[model samples]
Target chain A: MKFIHTSDWHIGRQLHNQSLLEDQRHVLTQIVELAKSNEVDAVVIAGDIYDRSVPPANAVALLDEVVNQLVNELGIKVIMIAGNHDGHERLGFASRQMQQSGLYIIGPLTSHIEPIVLQGKQGGAAFYPLPYAEPATVRHLYDCAASTHEEAMIALLEAVTAHDSQGLPKVVIGHCFLDGGSESESERPLSIGGADKISPSLFKDFDYTALGHLHGPQYKGQEHTRYSGSILKYSFSEQKQKKSVTLVEFDADNKPQISLLPLTAMRDVRIVDGALDELLAAAENDANRDDYLMVRLSDKHAILDAMGKLRSVYPNVLHLERTGLMASNEQLGIRADHIKKGELEMFADFFSQVSGEPLTQAQQQMMVDTIDALHKSEDNQ
Target chain B: MKFIHTSDWHIGRQLHNQSLLEDQRHVLTQIVELAKSNEVDAVVIAGDIYDRSVPPANAVALLDEVVNQLVNELGIKVIMIAGNHDGHERLGFASRQMQQSGLYIIGPLTSHIEPIVLQGKQGGAAFYPLPYAEPATVRHLYDCAASTHEEAMIALLEAVTAHDSQGLPKVVIGHCFLDGGSESESERPLSIGGADKISPSLFKDFDYTALGHLHGPQYKGQEHTRYSGSILKYSFSEQKQKKSVTLVEFDADNKPQISLLPLTAMRDVRIVDGALDELLAAAENDANRDDYLMVRLSDKHAILDAMGKLRSVYPNVLHLERTGLMASNEQLGIRADHIKKGELEMFADFFSQVSGEPLTQAQQQMMVDTIDALHKSEDNQ
Candidate 1:
């Protein structure tokens, strides 16, 4: 059976909730489009549906619309598991009814899991859904019969496969970090007592495993076990790689064939190194010029017009850093007299230092006095 | 139709987790036993089965056993709604299946909802399950046509009661804080946006309103609305009242007769105020001595041996506060040295204020010196 394997749809996430919703909505729309065009039989989302246990109304609406498109419009079967970041019970709600609507939810850790079987042109496939598990959950699930998550999962799998009347091709979807998988900046840690690491060997039995919790897509020695990766570029560290989804096909015997489908965003991210105008010129004709850009510039003279100049072209610019490497070669002209002011008092001085700009000595003093006065009453407290 | 209407079953709750589960289990067992003996047709939990959105495994097991007993042993039906404390999706999991097994979950919310009708020996009854709603949820549920929670809830009820087809006695089960209900010590704050209270007029269409929040079985205004209160007494303030389950009998026209079923617990909390020895003497025949007890003693001199003296008889005296209200005779014998040392440094001075132990004069001086040194260091820094 052909299915799209994806996970870690952390809906309602905010980069500190700093108006990134416009960007988030854009990428999420693109993912829905991909699912529609791909005509995938099923879409398996492996957990982390919401960044928090209590999702905001907008986040809930977003999922409702997206799932509606997948199930009602695209006629694609959707199976979701609860991730470590999710409130399992919250995510697991209406799972029984959603199953009738072709949306299956697996949030609770179950010892006797019912494997959802998806039929394909080639034959049939069994979808085993495993939500992320903590030691306490494992202990309770297995009746204290299994001490750790690995033992409990392994035992559950053994019991499930034992009940498989005809050993059809089986695919397991999970939200766990494998021991050998690559991690990206956005992955949350699964703590054991206090440590956030779990062994990867727990998922060895399934024909193919689509894992989540790790933002970077990676393989765990066995080709079938892989990370599906996150949908969007969430951080500066993730700015380099082109994020993608995994598509898999099971042959007649249920043996699988896997491939990656790269996603090109409306705006890619690029970090550039050059002087202000030079960087702006280079950014103009580049393939990823319209992307969210961060630049580090070296300037000797005050570039009072730097941000004004750069933002005209790259409105999504996140940062601009000025280097002192060129100061020895050229007579750098900026207010060195502003340095004596304390750290919080020197906003204009610091901005000048980092932007190769000059703040008037009066402006610098004003910045200092304004900041100091703000703290004057605070000190009394 | 006769059923026990109990709400706010904040399972996994704790009086700091000290004797929390024991009280909860005891109260729940009593509630079920009352239901069994009363030959109730069903048990209706308005909301809040778990304290937090994510309930512990123990809470889940406890719920499972009680629900199983209500259905299998007593042949009673159970209907529930997702309370504000509940994660809607989690409460919704297996809801359909559970409904098929004589359990009705009224969590799936929509704007124009029909009242859930239940048929019993009384002929017929109508139920409207309204989960707690924030302004945003309320707006969304009403399709943005209504912005305020009150307006949205009113719209929802108008739609629900529109199908008052049989004119049967309609009961509304909701998890909301009505404006005038008695607030319990353990109830969580429902809103952070300045105000969170919702008016009780939203239930004018229903004959009996079974409500979940505000853990005291009381009414809002003169309305038929009633709060079943929380299962366990989660705070010391609720010690005097008997935690109970409410039984409602609906006649052919669905007009209701309600009775309060007392839920006796293994331990009853009692407060005794006097000198430690006197209070202990008064508690000698504690009919419920195995009960948890709090002892408040008032004395001018420090009773360094208080807990030691009281623990022998009232073993579960979890609290011993020295309120320091002295009688005239006790204050008559104060030595000059005792006055100089103040109450804390006298030989009879109470145990260390924090640890409840007798403090040596030398130890007291050292503590003062250390605090002084630390303050000096901080000031220097």
Candidate 2:
């Protein structure tokens, strides 16, 4: 059985307020072409189908068009799950009915999961998909006392294990932060700290595990478990990373072979660093001038309308900074980190700083609950 | 053949910033029960399934559940369309596949429409559903010269008339403001003025025209052509209106019979007029204290924390107005009207007030284009 493994499409993501829909559409078309050329029996998208709970209309249209081509035109099975960024209910719309058309979408954690089995000429594999779910939601659904992400995942995996009595080879699809997985600027943290990270050993009994959330494609400790990563460079920090999908094939003996299939972006995201004048000269001959760029000027003096000047040649320049002047200032880095931290984390840090005591686990849980309630109320409005 | 005709669900609508999901869910349940009890051959939901382009998660879940029950459980055919409030592409997701399950959803104004034919034991009707489309979109889609809603509707209805060569009775389902229809505060204006309203005579060829966008259930000089109104009282102005769905029965002679099937809201929206003291006294024995209320205080003097006090007794009181003090003031009415006008309308009014001349059609079109482009840019973010 051969399958294309990918995740974190983030269909409606934007970089520095610039829409990435065109970039996304370009990469997705390539993915569909790859699936057709490889003749993969199924495409497994682990999670994060969209950047936000409510995706824009054009994003929805793009997804519908791509999925229609893959499932209806190419006749390939699609297995997808909802990530933390997705509103599970909205993503799972008409999911049950769609299953008959070879598009399987799983959303919201429940007690019982019926494994989706894909059959190929060689053999078949049963897939157990676990979409991202909060520990509080896990407790409510399963009636389990899981106060942490690890505990919640364990409970979910236990259910999967019980349902693994089928004779076919088993593959687990999940969206989570593994214990040692690398973090990226674009990935939203599941929790305030390491409590959300789970050990990769939970999938030990499964033949393979396809993971998502991290933006770089890599494996944890084992080769059978891997993250195919995002389809595009979502942030400047991911500029150097090569985006790809994983092609997995199960042998007649149920052994797995994996390989990375590189994807070409419509316009690459790149960083250009030099003096303002030198960068402007370089842009004159740059073949990929339309690529999204982060220009770091090395000149010490302030350049008037630096961004406007750069954009004249490189129309897609998304960010500009004076690296030479700010490289020695550690405060800038601290402020960026502060901006990334959630309100709860910042409050926790303030409490520890002012009172010389960290909040207790119970106190942190209370705060999480209160903050979640507040957000829900605001969302209602 | 009998069918339940309804429209303007506004599933995620709010009343003065208060979430109406519970009320919507309750009313939708009643609608489903009504269909079941009537044993209608089909349920034709004209348009406006959602209140906004992007609905919240809970609203999506509710719509999913309701549609699932109607199509899968009850085995009834449900045909829906997108309204001005809906992002057509988003609303049309999985629509093609859903048609196999007897759920038909039409979105954007396309060049061609395949009429949905619902068959019953007694016979059937061919439904031509036209989802709301902006004049620009219509012009782009059909490559026509239509620059107004009336012209666009005429072009679309021409296509419907062309497809009506079939022997089945033609039923037109549309979402548009008809000429001479009473307006309501809740209905979002499709355009600046009467340019969005079309003549009712345009649907003269169809046996029955089930319309939407108006919040009052009424016929426009003809019983066969009618507005089903909204499912609930979306605004205080609709407090006196009785919301209902139109049930249309077609006989063997191709004639139509229309009846109104009323819906009951979980929490009624009401306005209470009296002094604060008297209102509180009356609330002691009020059976429906939790109903959404607008308190009009008649006290001549000031009442501190009036809203806070009324909320204690009438827990769902959403608004408190000092009608006693403002009774003699026409400025307040003028201010209310000013607030209701759109930016373009306000600008036009201001321009007219200062220059004593109305904006030329070309200039008005330019302002509309600029404003739309600005809004589109913001929405992309």
Candidate 3:
């Protein structure tokens, strides 16, 4: 059976105090379009549908509509689970009724050991939707059993296997930081206030593990266990990473074939560093200059006029920084411009009239000296 | 068509430091059960499905389950809209598809003035799922020359009437507060913060205004316009009020027959005040006394003995206060048990222990003498 796997939509979110609703919407529309075109059997959203446990109303509405479209319009069945960032009880509410419809939402905390059998035309498979379970909760829930985060997770899988009478292929959907998955700063911290760490080996029993929480389309290995990534880029750091949903095909034997569904953002993020003239020269011929640029110019002294100079070229530039360093002469093909006699003196004379904190004589000389150094560096290159 | 109307489910929420996930689950489940038993044609969640724009994954999962159940299991159609506390684009992601699956979710900023047509068992009605729109947005969306929240809302409805061809009865589900609906602190703040304060007359064009955002179940002078209130009270002050879902029966004229479906808390919350003895005297008789209790005792003379006295009866006593009068009045029964005594000794003992400065004997005597005089009045009362 072939199914599209997507996780971590994180709808209705904010970053840098600016709302990402528009951005999230832009991407989700694309995902739905992708799903429709792909013609997959069903969709499995592993976890983290929202950024926070208490999502805003609009976020809820967004999911409501999206699911409605998928189930009603597209005629797709969706199986979703709650994550650690979710309030388990809240997610499980009205689940019984929902399941009776084609929406298979698994939010059972204690019943994680049991699998929801997906009976289909091709064959059948059991889906175990494990929200988040803490070790303490497991011990209390399972008669004071020895419980660790990893152990509790394994214990639940064991339960799933125990109940696998139909012997169908099994899929486990979850939200966790595996023992080896790489994480960025934007991901939720799960150190448990310095208490526990989860091991990926705990999930060895399942034929496939569709993970959430991490916003990257990569894997601990190359197959079976993978992150579909968030619906949106979410942060400046993530601007360049390829975001994609995963499609997994599980055979009767539970072996799987996986493919990536690439998602591209409307804007590209590019960073550049150089001095005033050199930076301008490079950007002038640059193909993607209109991309959302994070230009980090290595111009000695502050560039108060930098924004204005760059804005005309890269109007959508989101950031500008002046880091002190020599421009890369080889990369820019910057030629040393000739300095006419007394040009510095003329410029200094003009500068004196612009404002009240006029540069001291020594400061004026420093400017000329800096220009000479720039010229000398260009000559060497 | 008789149906359950609920709104402002800020799932994945916290009230103060307390988690409301369990409460949300309990209440939402009750609403679904109520709808199933009553056999309503549809469930209208006016707006604010989540507390914040980014609901936690759990909230999303639960909502998916509940909504799925309402449609699939209970055979009830769910028609929802966006509210002020939402990011519309995200919530309405799959609205188009949801419509095909027998669920109608009106999300985001829409200029389509025509109300959604609902063919109920009792004939048909025009269901206008009006999302909350800002004045500027409304002007832009409908190209309506209107300003102010009320004007914008009215303009949208007028446009609805002008464009709608479904002439059966008409009902409008909206997120607005009338002049009379009391505001809960957890609600989006009033006009100053962009929360729309609109009169029910804007909805006079329709049979029923199923409102959201306000956390109280109420109806304005127009019997047809009702606020379903929030699914759960989100603050300490809301403890006294019962949270409920409104049931509305719409006729051919689109007028409503409204009733409140009372919701009970899984755990009871109570605040009690008294001296140690009076509190313990009542605790033994209180049925749910062992439930979560916030005890405030006005006891005099450091009641070091109080914790030991109360711990036996109350398992989760969060707050404890000690006032001088209460500690001194730990007598059995006979409230206002006037015979006051030993004020000077109590004052002398307390001051002697707490103060850093070595107070003189005369000073201590003066302080005690003052307290004794105050106790004299209590002795009489």
Candidate 4:
């Protein structure tokens, strides 16, 4: 059976307060198109269907549209699990009824992990979905002394494997921070430092393990075990990483062949560093104008309305940094004695630094008058 | 065709900082049982499925369980609409796929309201679900001059009737405030004052109109047009209102025979008023001990630890009021001369009134010392 393996959709996520709903819609539409063209039997979404437990209305709508297209329009089966970012109960709501139409949503882990078996021309493959659950819950549920995530995962896998002695060409889907997997800023830390990391060796028995939670498209230990990564670059730290969905095809023997298909964003996130004039010149090129950009200026002085000027040329510029000014100004730090000075003197110093010029005579007089009136009012009170 | 009509579920609602989830669960379970025993063809949930747009996880889970039982287990059809309290897009998510399994959920209103026709042993009945939508949206959607909800309803009904020239038996499900309908504190006002009030004349053509939005189960102008009310008492104002689900059975001619089946709450809300001693004597009977009680004490004197004392007899006392004290205190208002007095003098007056005794000489000295220390601290600042 051939299927599109994807996870970490993180719908309703925002980058620097900018909504990515349109971007999410664009990519999800492409996924639906890819599914239709490839004629995949099923789509496996491992976890993190939403960025938060209670997502905004638009995010919910986008998810509805995509699921409707894939399950109703394309007539393909969808198997999904709740990730750490999701509210397990909320995501799992109405899932039983929904599954009647070929949408399988598994929520919080239970002692009895049911496998959803899918039949193909050659044979049937049983899919074991292990949604993200806390170690304490697992320990209590299984009546075991699993104190860590790895221990909990191992116990769960052993339980499922023991029940499925017939094998039936099994595949496991999970959401975890595997040991040796790369990290990104947007991915919430699963545990303190490396304590929560689980080695990929535990899944050696499975033909293939599709994973989520780490927002980078790469392998942990083996070629068959992979993270499809987030569909979008969720943070500026992920600026250099390529985002993609993993496509896994099963052979006659149930062994898997995996491939990565890159996803093109509606607007790419780019960080450009140069002098103000150089950045403006670069923005003149139409190719750079539309990308969501964070520009760092290296000029040794504060530019007047730098963000406004940059936005005029680069319409999608989200952030602006005066690196050169900050670095130089760090040396000329405010002295404790300066804080003890009168309000007018402090205002004059701040005005000079920001405008790159001394305050005018009229401006200085206005500042003094304002300060005097304020003191007079305070005395009256 | 016969169906159980219910609305204003307001799941996840809280009363006096207490969770009513267990109460809601009990009532919903009873509803499911009623559906099975009655063997209804469909269950129509008019609107206000949740108390808030973004409900807590438990509310979502409860809704999921109830819907699963009604549609999957019992094989009954469910028709729901979005109310003002619900997030329309969120509630309507995956509705298209859900409809495949006989669960029809309508969200925002549109120009064309498609009817879901349910054919019974006798004849076919068309159900036109009119979800809650703003007047502006209806006006823009149909391009009509509808400034009020009544006008919008008229325009929408006209549009539906104009399209449905087949003359099939029809029932309209809606969530709106009709004129002359009694309301409670819990039901959110659809619009300011009388502007939102629509008349029962709009549904004169239909055999029956199942309504929601008002928390009282009553008819407006006609018996065929009615509100089923909420299943639970959401506020003290609704304490006297008897809650019920409206059972509508259609005959061979498709005319609805409506009856109200009273719903029993897990814990009843009660309001009791009398002197404190009289209330304690009444509580000695132990008949209404388990009921959630709001007590109003009529004694003119202040009672120390009244709540604590009352709770011993009435364990579920949620609120306590001293109406006699408030009435008498209004006449003995705060004097302007008291404002000029020292803090210690003001404290003495307050202490005397509450304790019904003057402060001891030692207590007065302590008050003086404390006030002196507070003044010194303020001077230091």
Write the residue-wise lDDT of candidate 4 on A245-325 in tens digits: 888888877788788888999999878889989888776666758878888788887689989888888888887767777
Model 1, residue A208: distance off in Å is 2.5
Which CAPRI category fits model 4? acceptable
Among residues 3 or more apart in sequence or in different chains, the pairs in candidate 2 whose N, CA or C atoms overlap within 3 Å are none
Docking class of 3: incorrect
- Return the top candidate by DockQ: 2
Worst 10 residues of 3 chain A by lDDT: A332-341
Which ranges in model 2 have alpha carbons more than 4 Å from their true place?
A272-286, A295-315, A320-381, B274-286, B297-313, B327-381
Per-candidate Cα lDDT values, in order, are 0.68, 0.86, 0.69, 0.83
The order of the candidates by TM-score, greatest first, is 2, 4, 1, 3
Over B1-381, each residue of candidate 4 has an lDDT whose tens digit, in order, gives 888999999998888988899999999999998888888888899899988777777788889889999999999899999988887877887787777788998976756788898865455678889998767779899899998999989988875576562656688899998988887867766653246889888887788898999988998877889899999998777889999999989886767889888888888987888999988888778786877888878898978999999999998888877877785655424543464345677798899999999999999888866865664343222
* lDDT by residue for model 1 (B13-113), tens: 76633536667777788888888888888888998887766565557656766776777667778888887777565455435444545677755475655
Give the clashing residue pairs of candidate 1, or none: A89-B90, A90-B90, A93-B89, A94-B92, A179-A200, B351-B357, B352-B357
Measured by lDDT, the strongest candidate is: 2
* Candidate 4 runs further than 4 Å off: A120-124, A163-168, A326-381, B120-124, B163-168, B328-381
Output the lDDT of residue B77, model 3: 84
TM-score for each prediction?
A: 0.68, 0.89, 0.58, 0.84
Per-candidate RMSD, Å: 14.7, 3.6, 18.1, 15.0
Q: Give me the displacement of residue A275 in model 2, in angstroms.
A: 5.1
